[model samples]
Target: MIALLRGFLWLTGFWLAGESLVVLLDLPISAGVVGMLLLTIALLLRIGRLEDIAAASQPLIGLLAMLIMPGVVGVFFVADEFAGQWLAVAVALVGGTLASVLTTLLLMRRCMPAAPRTETPQETSS
Candidate 1:
């Protein structure tokens, strides 16, 4: 429980810091993204270990479907605007998914190649 609270507080602190930066610097990016960047930096700097936040974030990530429902509902409400552009939306979604998959495959191939296997020949019995 204490670990969960610490994680929540840590995440909140980073999020608030991000929002504060947005306010101060007038960045076009959203505060949540800035908070993510801060979190990444903190991890890379060894200041914030991922284990500290994993407990708190895991359950929240599981609730993603519920969390995203509102956005989905909003999209449904805007369906009228999208009705005429259905083909464009379909193409965009499919193209983006294919591009992302191909890019990930390419990166994995470059970054994580499989170990080579060596085969030995068997001697035939006389």
Candidate 2:
């Protein structure tokens, strides 16, 4: 229970920071998203350890599916409305997936150093 409380505190603190950034910077992004980005940056920079977060959040992680039920149900209720925009939906899904893949590739390329090159002797004759 204490772990849960600490995790919630950490999550809430990051969320508040995200909200502050959104309000002060006038960003179009959501507070939650901004907060997550901030958290990622901090983790990458080794400013915080994952164990500190996992200790608190691990308890709630199992309930993630239950937490999303309302959103899933809302979408189900609007299924008919969405049917009319199947083409648009398809486009958005495909486009978003493509963009995500490309973005990941770019980030990996930028963050990871290139492998050392090796030349085969078969090409030396030319």
Residues 53-108 of candidate 1 have per-residue lDDT tens digits of 87778877899899989888787688787678988989999999999999999999
Which lDDT tens digits does candidate 2 get at residues 1-126?
A: 666676678888899999999999999999999998988888788875577777766767788899988888787677787778988998999999999999999999999877545645556787
Off by over 4 Å in 1: 48-51, 99-126
Each model's lDDT comes to 0.85, 0.83
TM-score of each: 0.69, 0.58
Model 1, TM vs. native:
0.69
Q: Which pairs clash in the backbone of model 1? A: none
TM-score of structure candidate 2: 0.58
Question: Model 2: residues >4 Å from true position, as ranges?
Answer: 44-50, 79-83, 87-126
> Model 2: which ten-residue window has the lowest total lDDT?
114-123
Count of backbone clashes, every candidate in sequence: 0, 0
